[model samples]
Target: MKIALDAMGGDFAPQAAVDGAVLAAQQLAGKARIVLIGQEDAVRPLLEKHGAAAAELELVPASQIIEMGEHPAKAYQQKQDSSIAVGYRMLHTGEVEAFCSAGNTGAMLVGAMFSVKPVPGVMRPAIANFVPKLHGGLGILLDVGANAECKPEMLEQFGELGSLYAQYVLGIDKPKVGLMNLGEEEGKGTSITQAAHQLLKVNPHIHFIGNIEGRDLFNDKADVIVCDGYTGNVMLKMAESIYDIMADKKMQDPFFDKFNYEAVGGSPILGINDNAIIGHGVSTPLAICNMLLQGYQMAHSGISDQIKNTFKS
Candidate 1:
């Protein structure tokens, strides 16, 4: 499998990305190839500094970079030769199987939508994050920030998207889908959730398990939690803060440590026609390595093709 990395996407830029590529190259040797996209002058020296031969990985030259603070849509349009844009071009043209970036989240989303586009029948592409379960397993949460306002049909589709991701990527069998709401009882949330509940409950494709409250996020009650982007993003940030607070207090626990974003590396933009992984802007070398590995996993698992087939039927 071939995976492309935006070497100039993160705050740390070419250094962190190059080092991470070297790490991934060492571990993924003979399994997959890593392609670094960025200005050749900036990326090549860093590869050598990290004791990685230029021949070990493919280098694709991109003359520009999309800054973290730049407008997502505008930057992507103006900077045609930017690393993010180039990576997406490679992905759309099938030059690479997957593309990942820790750069501007908005730019990544824009490229995903405009480049390879969404799978047919998918209402809106959803971004999924992994939630650590108490029983040493991981749960999937969708619409983590993709769509703040969603219709009932969108939520229903999220259930199917999240279910397929859980089954194919996370190796879960018959994953239970849950709607995030104020109460576990029916008709507890707003008009949207109530309507969404009806749709999901009747959908033959999903194993709907009623509603799941905020407190049940880390428990084993549900394997896939579907919510509007507004609520899901807030929950994801709160979960991230738990790890930050623990690290500040010098607390150490295996379960709590699992909350670190570095462990999961990045979140995949599900329901898109191609594989696109988005990482934190402040991703470190380890996080970058993990992000590349996650992209490779997504491409190798053929989850995108599976979703397309499911939507077609």
Candidate 2:
């Protein structure tokens, strides 16, 4: 299998991306090959710097680049030869099993929709983030920054999407799904949440655990927390801030360390027909490496197929 990465997408691009791809290549040696997509002139020199160590890495030239500040839809449409665009084409053509980029998040989502498209029955594809569990392991949070406003049905689908990821990729069995609300009670949220709760409770696809409060984020109360992008994005940023604060204070706690973005690498765009992950803009080599590994896991787990099958019925 082949895994693709946008070599020029992140702030530390070409160098950090090259270094990360090499690290992932070393770990995934004999298992999968890493494909780097970027401008030839910019990326080749760095790969050459690795000597024979980089010989195994494949470089695909893409002259154009989608800048971070450019409008996602406009940039993606105009920059057809951009690294992100080229990577998506490769993924769509089955040349690569999965694609990872720390570039523009909006562009990644645009590529997913325009290229591989969403699952047959999926209303919308969601951006999923990992949550550190209090007891052990990680939980799934959906719609992190995808659709800031979602309908009741969309929230219901987010639950199913998050459940499939938790079960297939995270290796959790019968993952408990929960609606992130103000209270644990079923009728404690907005009209949308109340309606979504009813829809989720009867959905046989997941083990619905009722509504969950913000404090339950790290607890066993829910393995898959469902919410609109507006709420989930806030939680994700808050966790990131906490991690940064702890690092500044030199706290060094194991649980808090899990909050580091480098640990998970990137956020997977779920409910799409193919696997695609969006990484942080300022990704370091370590973060990029983990993101590639995550792509490999998503591809190997056949999570996309699982989602298609579930939604089809």
Candidate 3:
């Protein structure tokens, strides 16, 4: 398998991208290859400086760069030669099995929607983040910043999407799906959650559990949590802040350490035609390394194909 990396997309740019590629090359040796996309002059030297042999990595030249602050649609259209745009072109044409970037999240989302498109039966594609459970395990949470305003049907679809991800990628069998709500009762949340609960309860594709409260996020009550993008995004940021605050206090608990974003590398854009992993803008070398590995895992595991089949039926 071949995974493409946007060498100029992140704050650290070519240096961190190159270093991470080298680390991933050593770890994924003989199993997969890393393709770096950026200005050749800037990327090649970094590869050499990082002691990555030419045989280990392939460089794709891109002339321009889409800055982090640029508009997603405009930058993608105007800068066709930018690293992010070129990376999407490669993914569209099947030049690589997966594409990863820590660059503009909006551009990545736009590119995935227009370039590769969504699965046939999927109403809307969802983005998912891994929730670190308290019992030394992980749960899947969906629609975390994509489609902030969702209908009840969209939330129902997210349950199926999250369930497939938990099953295929995380190796969870018969993952229990739960809707995030203020209370655990049947009619707890707003009109949307109440309607979504009815839809989820009747869906055969997912093992629908009752509503899961905020305190249950860290426990093993549910393996897949579905919520609107607005709520899910807030929950994700709040969880992230816990880690930041703990780190500031110099706390070193094993459970809290799992909250670090670097451990998961990046979150994959699920329900798309191909693998498109999005990393944090401030991703470090370790984070980028994990991002590349996650991209490779997504491709090799054939999660996209499995999702497509499920949706088609």
Per-model TM against the reference: 0.98, 0.99, 0.98
Listed per candidate, the RMSD to the true structure in angstroms reads 1.0, 0.7, 1.0
Please report how far candidate 3 places residue 59 from its true position, in Å. 0.8
> What's the alpha carbon RMSD for model 1?
1.0
TM-score rank, highest first? 2, 1, 3
lDDT of each: 0.93, 0.95, 0.91
Number of backbone clashes in candidate 1: 0
Instruction: Give candidate 3's whole-model lDDT.
Output: 0.91
Off by over 4 Å in 1: 52-54
State which candidate has the highest TM-score: 2
Residues 1-313, model 2: lDDT tens digits? 9999999999999899999999999999999999999989999999999888798799999999898999999999999999999999999999999999999999999999999999999999999999999898999999999999999999999999999999999999999999999988878999999999999999988899999999999999999999999999999999999999999999998998999999989999999999999999999999999999999999999999999999888
Q: What does the lDDT read for residue 194 in candidate 2?
A: 96
User: Which digits, one per residue and each the tens of the lDDT, describe model 1 over residues 208-308?
Assistant: 99999999999998999999999999999998998999999999999999999989889999999999999988888899999999898899899999999
| Cand. 2 TM to true fold | 0.99
In model 2, which runs have C-alpha deviations exceeding 4 angstroms? none
Candidate 3, which segments miss by more than 4 Å at Cα? Answer: 52-54
